[model samples]
Target: MVQKIVHDWATGKIYPHFQFVFSFKFRDLNTLNCSINLSNLIVVFYPYLRNALDYIWKNPERLLFIFDGLDEFKSKIDFADNCTEQQHKCPDPDVRCKVSDIVYSLIQHKLLPGCSVLNLQPSQFLSGFLMELLEREDSVRSVVYTFPHLTIQEFVAALAQFLTVAPRNIVKLLSEAHSATDGRFEVFLRFVAGLSSPRSARVLEEFLGPFPNETTCRVIDWVKEEIKRQAGNTWSEFGKRSLLNTLHYLFESQNPALAQQTLGSVETLSFRGLGLTPIDCAVLSHVIRWRFGLLHGTVISRIGECQIPRARRSNPASGLVEPLRLLMLPTSFSRDYEFPM
Candidate 1:
């Protein structure tokens, strides 16, 4: 429902007249000082709103406040606390109080009674299709089970892009995902890349419906541009991880020609102080095979238990004779292993 509201607002389908519609993450709100009042808070967070403070005070109903990710809120909300009684009687929006008190007052209709407040948490059903897939009920209990693995969930999110009628801006979505600090969108981006394959699209169409061929092509093109953009610059650890993720996305696409074209000029590949899964190793091997002649000095360090298969480590068919170097390996797998590149 929050998403729907946001979408409607964005498209000017609802709240068209409202000039002050503020959306804030619950975690960001929790950082407010205890003595801050609604009036000061608005100016502190949004200085432009300072000019409209009097208007806001008089016409609170015109403003819509949306608080998202309540499930991640660190503080508990106690509706029956003694502080509620004090807050309820103090109806002035400018009165200084704890941020929690302000939240309670707002919810209880004591402060900004005419304004609308929307609180969104993950426990609430976000989509009917998702509810149908994950929600189950029995005689005594109800439960919601997520996909067995994180990758499956990410893939489903990626699939949702094609299922929607609206044209997806692949570059914008990728940019947003790339900027996220939590690594939440890493696998989802890879799945988006994988879904670009015609074989994958046809398989999905058999069960879901026809996917927009143009969107898939756009994703492929974006992936190529991203790889090319990063190829020239020297990368730090974080950037190296991003390059590795790009390799994974390319491998997921299963387009050998695309991989070769995008990564043909890559000279050195370094994945230092990073944990690698068996799947990650496989993806790395695919890139190595493509750029065997051009790539030199591939450095992998601090890979604890991720064992690269000896056969995959070397490819005799490629007829390449570049000595592979393993640096700072764990005691268990200290022996020299040939890398295909």
Candidate 2:
């Protein structure tokens, strides 16, 4: 809108009065010293809204104003009996009053008679603004979300790895109690935190670092809450694989060495100029090493229990030594070996 106004001035074109439209949002209206009256209206020179008044005045039949998200407007709207009756008189558009009064006037049909108005407010049933708009009409329409079970499913799926429920148990729980749960699972985020115990919530926070957005911050806050909650829960092996998966994803990143830091550098870290300060790469690497150690010990112990016959181990067609060399290959040996899938 600003660009259009500026362009007309620069290019020797007349202002488009018919195209003039203005939206006074919560923050925008707060800038006015007083309510949006003729004085403040002209202060901004919003392309002659008088023309809009005139146009709407002439065509008072069908609904003209479509006000969406009325809950977002911080201004207090007047719905008192006397105020409603007075505004029903359709006060002058130029009248010096609050913007809320203007909206009330429009809503009551006093401001612009015969014109239709639809206002959408939050979390209220029928006979709200609809009652005034529909004016005692016999018929109205509405629909409700019938699938309340979906919320439970979504919450469970998101935190499945954190829960100790096995595959069969999860399937049984979903089938038997899906409807009964009805959003109760949303409260169990700390349950997941308890499972991520070895990696405490503080440790997780240390990994996530700084978030530049509300969404990330909210997630981090919930996770922190879960971590504290998890401290009281019993130990579960449910989250070990999930932790490994997180480490694997980090290992595949461009700078794996830096990406996997438990106590990340004091200065904030970013990936590809995007705002992502990962929690702890060092801890992840440590966890991976610990897992490897356990697996190595188990494998060695099993091999010791049943000694391999030297003749079978030396079978030429097995290509066993080549695979071993790849498994323990050093940084220097990386360039020398490029094994097939």
Q: Of the candidates shown, which would achieve the greatest TM-score relative to the real structure?
A: 1
Tens digit per residue, CA lDDT, model 1, 97-202 = 7766676777666787666565666433333234224322222221224565666678778887776555567679887897676788988998898888887778
lDDT of 2 by residue, 1-341 (tens): 23333355346453222233233344455555565553345346456554465554464453334444566777677766565544443376557776667678766666645544545433222212222222222223321122235544343343343322222243234223322334344233323323233333344334223212332233333333322332223133223222222333233222222332331221211111111112233333233333222223222211212211111122369766332211211133112211111
Which candidate number has the best lDDT?
1
Indicate the worst ten consecutive residues by lDDT in candidate 1. 135-144
Q: At residue 248, what lDDT does model 1 achieve? A: 81
Candidate 2, residue 306: how far the Cα is off, in Å? 29
lDDT of every model, 2 decimals:
0.65, 0.36
Off by over 4 Å in 1: 1-132, 136-152, 166-168, 292-341
Global local distance difference test of model 1: 0.65
Ten-residue stretch with the least lDDT total in model 2: 268-277
lDDT of model 1 at residue 263?
72
Clashing pairs for model 1 are 313-340
